[model samples]
Target chain A: MIFAVMVALLVTMVLALVRAFMGPGLYNRILAINTFGTKTVLFVAVAGFLFGRPEFLDIGILYALVNFVATVAVLRLTHLQDPWSGTEGGEAG
Target chain B: MSLLDHDPTGVASAQNRRRKSTVRLLRTAPLPAVFWLLLSGRYEPLTLALGTLSVAAVCWLTWRAGLAHQSLRLAFVLRLPRYFLWLSGQVLVSAYGVARKVWSPRLVLRPVVESTPAADLPELSQVVYANSITLTPGTLSLDVDEDAIKVHSLEQAGVEELRQGRMLSRARRTEARG
Candidate 1:
């Protein structure tokens, strides 16, 4: 049963990765990446249970914290770039 | 505490700064210590002491790393349980909704970027709101500035919900209670 959950999370993560690669906009890519991160946490926790080691939840929490920091960092960088400005230095491109 | 006596060596100010950091360190220590205890699954005194020492050291380092040292307000801390319960409920509901939509034949995604005024809320509450949006399924907080937050929604429903400002009011109430 736990293995089934892990499999579903992995499938969701793959779908999110596909969306990240096919982004119509930068925010779309960021959103996909964030979703992937969340799925990764769930995947790790479920996989831990499937493998008979619940201690992996601690690592899952660590991944969650890292994911949040990464999201904040990416958001700050994107905001600073302001791709809509169209100026060379200001553009995300 | 003689403020009138100005020492040329500036020892008093240094002492004051150290004391402030110490207080911040203490305020933040217990949380990480409890986390460590739970993760380590140990009741041994040596392990507990080591955890305490490490948590204190890390807290002190972060405190000195120039992060704003807002001492945790007791009122805000007390409200965390309620806020988190509400947030988790929202996350679960949206996660289910998004999952169903993703599996449906119709890929009806209507993503949009909308800005909401953030200046009216306290700094911590602003952060809480942003994180809550990001944690939910259909909404992502793309940018947060002094005046507003830019959020991207996966569909019109999420967009309308945010526009209605129920979550914003809930966040404000949390901060207000604190």
Candidate 2:
């Protein structure tokens, strides 16, 4: 059952990935990735607990660490160098 | 050649030294951490202790990849009751709004992104803000920037209300923890 839930959430994230790929801009893609990371963390933890292994919680923690790293990397990629720059005409409705 | 032996001369040839140092660190340093976890009975203590070498190997790689730090030991604990109260209120309000849209003849979806200034909060506070936004029905925090957040809302008014940073009121709660 937990695996089923994880799969369902993964499916939603796949839709999100499409948006990220067709990204109107960098911010959109980063946002999609952030959402994907959060879902992945929950999926790991819930599945771990459901399986009665609880050992998978370690993977959940590691996922969270990696997610934080990924966010920081994305932020650095988008903002650290660009600082004050905003997209000139990329606003999408 | 016995790689474990220490050199009397401090420096080795660069190529072999780099490779040897990398493999050496991968073997020694993580055993203590893996042993601690096994002793603590946190996970499957039995599996962990019995599989000590395997656990150590994984820990070594995890630490090498820089994932194994003693996770932040919260000096101030997570205030579950207060957080729960706030979360439930937000959930109720959001659900009500979503229900209204569902019942209405036309599905009203006015999507907007409000710029939210995100200064004066710690990193965890920012994370909390982003996560909280997702839990709400009418809003999704698309991404967070140093002094700003981009929130997508289901209605113009919701977007406006969020831009006002009422959502950031809880940042103080995380100040101590961070």
Candidate 3:
């Protein structure tokens, strides 16, 4: 069961990467990477159970934190560097 | 070095500073200590002692950096588990949503960037809300401003869900107990 979960996570990650590569713009790539990071967190947690070394869950928690921090950092940097870069113009309703 | 002489300010305020630092240390150390214990997973005296030292060092550094603005309040802490459980359920639901979109034969993405007002939320919850948006599938928080959050969503539904203000209110409620 855990193995199946891991495989599903991997497939999602691959899809995210594909989106990242075929990005329409910078925001798309960032979103893709962020989704990939999230899936990696789940992948790590499930793999820990599948491999019978649940200690990896701790690392999974750390990865989740790192993923959030990195996303915020990258977004902030890009926004500061170019206020209207790849982000869509105007607020969508 | 004397017990409290580490305070460079040579005055009565020095004692107050030392006391405040000690209090901050006590407040901040426990969370990191617990993290260290869980991550290290060894009960030996040597490992425990090392973990304690490392946590103390980290706490001291954070204190010196003036990063200890929030006091440890029990009420807010108690509300965290409920908030986390809710967030986790949201994560799972959205993850499945994204998986379905990803596996669909047609590329049914109608990406939209929307802004949600987040100024009313407590300061800490603003971050929580932003991170939660990013963690959930189909929505990525592109910019977390003081007054609003700019989010990029893979579909229009994701933007609609965020604009509904459910998750933002929940995050604010998480900190309201204190």
Candidate 4:
């Protein structure tokens, strides 16, 4: 079952990868990459279970933090370059 | 203090959210989990130590890299449970749609984008909405606006149905009330 879940997440990752490649705008690419990161977390967790290593949950947790940090980085980068143009205080938190 | 119930009330204070997150993060990170794995007899000698070390290394590197940080509003953090429930149902429904298309005789994909809105909601909620949409099998949040979202769906009708869905409007309301 865990293997099956990993495969499904892989499929999702592939789709997101496709979107990332075919993006119409930078936001589209970032959205796809974000999706990829999330599914990767789920994939890691399930794969860990399948391999009889529940300890691998740490990887999943780490990936979760990485995902959030990546988004914040992108958000900050966008602010630096004024790409998203979606917030206040110019560099508002 | 007991681990389960020690000063539970004190933890609820908004000021503690940061401290709570920091501790919770350290506890749950892969290093500790891998440690648990070894302590509980899951990993062999070399594998156990290596696993924990690698997890720790990544955690340390990522933290120090200091990619960037924009602290989101507390309101968004508080609403995570509700968002998780909303996302589970959305992902399931979208998965079914994707599977049906995969197994069906003729592909009926009619993907389209519909303008929707996350008006009057905390920006964090909007970010969650955008992120969650990408997980659903047949839909992606292509563009978002304070007043609207451009949802790309596998079918135009899916986009239509999404506009009428409870999750979007309720999410909007929740953020608005924040």
List per-model TM-scores for chain B: 0.80, 0.61, 0.80, 0.54
lDDT of 3 by residue, A42-63 (tens): 8888888888998898899989
Q: TM-score of chain A for candidate 3?
A: 0.83
Candidate 3's C-alpha runs over 4 A off are A6-93, B1-18, B39-43
TM-score of each: 0.71, 0.47, 0.68, 0.52
Tens-place lDDT per residue, model 2, A1-93, is: 777887888897798889889999888988888888888888888887777888787788778989988888779776767532452222110
TM-score leader = 1
Candidate 4 off by > 4 Å? A1-43, A63-93, B1-79, B176-178
The collision pairs in model 3 are: none
Query: What is the lDDT for B75 in model 1?
Result: 86
Q: Identify the CAPRI category of the predicted complex in candidate 3.
A: incorrect
Compute the DockQ of candidate 2: 0.05
**lDDT of each structure?**
0.79, 0.69, 0.81, 0.69
lDDT of 4 by residue, A8-53 (tens): 8889999999999999898899889998998889888888888889
Q: How do the residues B1-178 of candidate 3 rate in per-residue lDDT, one tens digit apiece? A: 0112244666787778767767866888888988887678789999888888899898877766555544557877888899899989999999998889878999788898988778866657877899999989789998877689999998888888888889988888888853
- Better-scoring candidate (lDDT), 1 or 3: 3
Candidate closer to the true structure by lDDT (higher is better), 2 or 3: 3
Candidate 4 local lDDT, B1-178, one digit each (tens): 0112133456466457556545544644654565557555655788778777777765555444431122333575566667788779878977987998999998777778787666655655577667777777888888887667788888886667667756676566555535
Query: What's model 1's lDDT at A90?
Result: 16
CAPRI-style grade of the A/B interface in model 4: incorrect
Native interface contacts kept by each candidate, as a fraction: 0.00, 0.00, 0.00, 0.00
Q: Candidate 2's residue-wise lDDT over B1-178, tens digit each?
A: 1113343554555566567656655555456555556545656767666567665676566545433332333343355457657877988998898889978998777777776677766656676777888788888888778777888888788777766767777644644554
Off by over 4 Å in 2: A1-93, B1-70
DockQ, per model, reads 0.12, 0.05, 0.10, 0.10
